[model samples]
Target: MKILTNLFSVIASILLSASIAAAALDPVSINLRSDEKNPASPVMGDHLQFWSTITNTGTSPIEGLVAWISLVEIDPGNEQPVDLEDWSAHKAVTGASLKPGETLRTDWPMRLIKGGDYRVVVSVTDRGGRQVYTGPTIQFHVRQKPVLQAGRVLPVAAGIPLLFIGLIIFNNTRRRHGNGRL
Candidate 1:
């Protein structure tokens, strides 16, 4: 009976220690947003920046964490993940460390490439593959602003030459009728 009691006590202490360690290594929480106060409606060709806040809620410090941004198009029949190579110069932030209750803000500057519905998310993960933290999705629509629309340009292109011809004809007629001099 004494041996059994000792064995149970040892097991209980081990379990308690394991739980504490697990709690200390709890995953961090993150929030992602744009610095722009306006709703994230950016026109195509606009440059924008996003801010990500990563907070360590555990009792221990976290190290070797990596953060990156992902963009996915949600437009009808055009859904696909966007590559960050052309959109952003700086893609990922690595080797970030945070202490308990500490918050770190990361900046991601990107240029809007195509006009479509896109969802942006920021994710953080450790090198040990222990935990993957993802922030809320930010949905924004990229408006298409055509700088030179074919429909709008055709009229202007055709009208300019017609105006020049009309002016020449009027001057010729006036000269012919007014003794060819003024």
Candidate 2:
């Protein structure tokens, strides 16, 4: 009975410690907004405007904060964004310190020219160079590019088949030469 009690106590202590560590990793609060009220579609070469407000929930001060947003294609499979010049952008703040119970908000703006849903993650670090908090991944969607879809003489999806054909042709040639059957 004593051994069982000790085991239970150890397990409880371990769980509590795990929770505390995880909580410390990123204790942050975030609120994001956009100018457009309704969900609009995004095409190729479109600029997306966004705003973010980040708050520090930890006891330490935040030295800097960084935010990243990505757009992934929804159709067929969740594909990655194309022609993205800057998938990750950070606010320019040097020696910026945030005391406990303090919050920093920025009018963050970024351009989006991809088709699909996107996930965004924002992280803030402390003056001690420790990651204080990481915000949850935010998701958004983009509209398909109408011009590319219409003007495509060959389907982008066909590239897979073309690649496979090339591989097969190369393999056959190599095998034939290697086996003296060429």
Candidate 3:
């Protein structure tokens, strides 16, 4: 009987702790900025640069700060809210701790080769490793570099012929008018 009672107590304690953990965690902010205004679409490079900011909104400043920001490939164009934890390679955060209600921004230097779609996830833990807060992920895009492309030129490649043809046609029509034709 005592054993049963003790087991029930332990279970109850676990449940209570879980509830507290759940309560501790709330929504926070994760911001991402890119170097290139038009980052490579199908990004082609050894590494792409990124700047990220991780903020905490909980009542107390979080400690033992460890986070991950992943870049997952997204559909090329349309805007989407990406899940930061989805399909990420697992990159750790830089700072060690964050004070309650304070926003600590991390530089978040990353190396990305492909450029389709990507996002950033900011998660934090307390000193005892209790998950205190987790923020939603933000998505972005990367484009392929133009210089390495075999024949990826601007409008000039398709424009020159059209311009010449138009000019020739105009001049020919003018000549007919200048000659004795109506």
The best candidate by TM-score is 1
lDDT for each residue of candidate 1 in 1-182, tens digit (9 for 90 to 100): 99999999999999999987875565687889877654356898888888999998878778888999999999999899999899999789899888888998998888888888999999888786676777889888889988799999999999999999999999999889898565
lDDT winner, 1 or 3: 1
**Could you give the candidate ranking by lDDT, starting with the highest?**
1, 2, 3
TM-scores for the candidates: 0.66, 0.52, 0.44
Model 3 lDDT, full chain set: 0.61
Per residue, candidate 2 scores C-alpha lDDT tens digits across 68-154 of 433344445745543335642544334556767787776555566555677654455545665435556556676766764534746
User: What would the per-residue lDDT of candidate 3 be over residues 35-117, giving only the tens digit for each residue?
Assistant: 57434453655444555666765566666677666544557565464443323334676447666567766655455454466
Q: lDDT scores for all predictions? A: 0.86, 0.62, 0.61
Worst 10 residues of 2 by lDDT: 83-92
TM-score of 2: 0.52
The per-prediction tally of clashing pairs is: 0, 2, 13
Better of 1 and 2 by lDDT: 1
Worst 10 residues of 3 by lDDT: 81-90
What C-alpha lDDT, on a 0 to 100 scale, does residue 110 get in candidate 1? 83
